[model samples]
Target: MSENPHDQPETLEHPEEALHRRAIRSFVMRAGRMTDAQKRGIDHGWPRFGLSLEQGLLDLDQVFGRQAPRTLEIGFGMGHSLLEMAQVAPDQDFIGVEVHRPGVGSLLNGVLNAGIDNLRVFDCDAIEVLNRCIPDGSLDRVLLFFPDPWHKKKHNKRRIVQLGFAEALRQKLKVGGVFHMATDWQPYAEHMLEVMSAAPGYRNLAEGGGFVPRPEERPVTKFERRGERLGHGVWDLKFARSE
Candidate 1:
């Protein structure tokens, strides 16, 4: 559940060197073989549902054909939860950003199978997509579920919930639009709370200004179930863009 598809390096630099240079990326593209069905899905589905960086800034209204509440999810692993959210919402549009090919293919295949028109996907670094494609104050909700924890003490710098990221993400959301994040790693959850609490232009929705109970909107995925079985607790946080 700790796999992420954001903050990828621009070049192949040594890890220590990259760290020293302050070019900390949250993910590494691990090699994974795609199934035949996944490949077919990409071949067939992408032409219809894909959004590209080359498209420049997006007019989201034109993309979905109506101005509706939009949710943009970063690092959707295999798109199970994202698909479910789109299917259930119907009126809301969903944009998913991911760097993994296999996951993107799997999501595309699922979308094609489901015949859902409210979802679109980006197969690229999420930060780049936010900067180049997504317009300011355009999104109603932004979700980061089970992002890479980068648990090592030294590697903590690579975590995505830093102040800079929180601020950047805030710019993409409408005032009062929520940034929702979930994690199975307790330390990472605490880290998210710490950074987001200190970041400007936001207000935590949690009752005690801490972690919140998981909302029904976020589906409990197979990975989450497995983690629950192993006695790993999950934490959910929602912070609204208040500025």
Candidate 2:
């Protein structure tokens, strides 16, 4: 019997673990409505482009059909920019992990429309995907752009940039591999800086040991553009794993 493609488990070996994950999630799966096109995209594109949590650890070379730089983007909301990176970097293979079904469907639609072949997606929690599937020290780059800020003071604990998260991320990245993150929320950015600075086995890539200017490859998202127009500042942090 085949595994249910729709079940986004935290651990493929223990689907029961998903219940506890929901309580600690950095994101609250938005009950967004999926458009007909998005639904159709999942129907037509998932078989070719979607990856399941149930699939367990993946062989990057085998998955992409060739040896190449592997990049993973956590919470690639809607995937417009994720697709852009994949389109521009043909030599790299990208695996995007996102939890929202609507976003997954929407991205799948884009994958179909663009005729892209160098990307695959996991519709599950980023932590789970990292813990159970992605091999240690296998990724060359990890992109984490605009993750939820969890604004309220009471919810700051929910932010994904905690010390433990940073440590785990450091372990997964190959030596000299880049861990890049960007956020429009200033407070959250500062939080990121503090945590990442304290995390061992990594070095900041920015000058003066502070936030860096957005790199050329990171296309400004629609929400980010809106924030810019409204006088909001965006922070980019790039840290390399150090052995």
Q: Which stretches of candidate 1 lie over 4 Å from their true place?
A: 1-22
How high is the CA lDDT of each candidate model?
Answer: 0.87, 0.83
Give residue 211's lDDT in candidate 1 (0 to 100). 89
The alpha-carbon deviation from the true structure for residue 130 of candidate 1, after best TM-score superposition, in angstroms, is 0.6
Q: Give the clashing residue pairs of candidate 1, or none.
A: none
Residue-wise C-alpha lDDT for candidate 1, range 129-226, written one tens digit per residue: 88789999999999999999989876787777777777778888999999999999999999999988988899999998998988988999999999
Q: Per-residue lDDT tens digits of candidate 2, residues 1-243?
A: 222223232222232333224445577766778899889878998899888778888887888999989999999999889989998999889999888888889888988888879999999888888877888889999999999997987667777777667777776789999999999899999999998898778899999999988899998899899999999999999999987
Per-residue lDDT value at 139 in model 2: 94
> How does candidate 1 score on lDDT?
0.87
> Which 10 residues in a row give candidate 2 its minimum summed lDDT?
1-10
